[model samples]
Target: MLLNQFLVLGAALFAFGVYGLLVRRNVVLILLSVELMLNAVNINLIAFESYLVSAQAVGQVFAIFVITVAAAEVGIGLAIVLMIFRNRKSANVDDLSLMRW
Candidate 1:
């Protein structure tokens, strides 16, 4: 209901996302964690727009932009992960060192 509540929820989501990103080795789970973080950002943006900002739609527009970017990110991220899986026969991030050579 309140802006602070939304902010707390967003923070919690972001924290979980970060923890998942750091702990998970699978590319797919990492991508999902990234999506979680992005959603948290979107929540914060909308909350701020609704509570702090003026009547302008700037926050909503930014939120939309974030959503668009997140969608593209998921598409490209999944494609890259799929290719990696196909070539490496594994989806583990630790196995991604082949690109360094």
Candidate 2:
């Protein structure tokens, strides 16, 4: 019962995150959406880790690693976004075509 509820909530969060990522133009908003998705994944991993009494802490370790990677992604991503905005005066992904070869 509890797991079902958690799964539903996680699905909802992931859906919203995808929506935000697809629909938002602001770089900050996109970062926030990615964070939401990461959080949803973390919730599932923790829930499963708790449910499974196995000695293996694979899920917990994976969740922690995901958090670390997400943190680095956000930091680097935001920095790049800021630099692009500074150079082009726009944060819209659609407007970043000039940066690519």
Candidate 3:
């Protein structure tokens, strides 16, 4: 209910996302972790927007932008991942070396 509670929940979600991003080796899982981080940011934005009671709803607007960007990112990311998986037959991040000469 309180602002601090929302903030703490957001922080916790962000922390978990960071941990997953660092520890996961699968590309899909990495993408999911990124989504989690973005969701955490959204939660924080909404919480602040509600707490501030602003007329412009700036935080919510920014959150919407973030969501839009995240969606685009997921689309592009999955496309790349799908291509890589088709070529290599695995979705593990450690297996990707297409950037190297």
Best by lDDT: 3
How far off is residue 28 in model 2, in Å?
1.3
Better of 2 and 3 by TM-score: 3
lDDT of 1 by residue, 5-78 (tens): 99999999999999999999999999999999999999999999999776778999999999999999999999
Model 2, position 65, has a per-residue lDDT of 98
lDDT by residue (tens digit), candidate 2, 1-101 = 57778878888999999999999988899999999999999989887887784598988999999999999999999999989999999998888787488
**Shift of residue 39 alpha carbon in model 3, Å:** 0.4
lDDT of 3 by residue, 32-99 (tens): 99999999999999999999978999999999999999999999999999999999999998888779
Candidates 1 and 2, the one with greater TM-score = 1
Model 1: how far is 33 from its true place, Å? Answer: 0.1
Q: Return the TM-score for each candidate structure.
A: 0.92, 0.89, 0.92
In terms of lDDT, the poorest run of 10 residues in model 3 is 92-101
For model 2, the run of ten residues with the poorest summed lDDT: 45-54
In model 1, the runs with Cα more than 4 Å from the true position are 99-101
Clashing pairs in 2: none
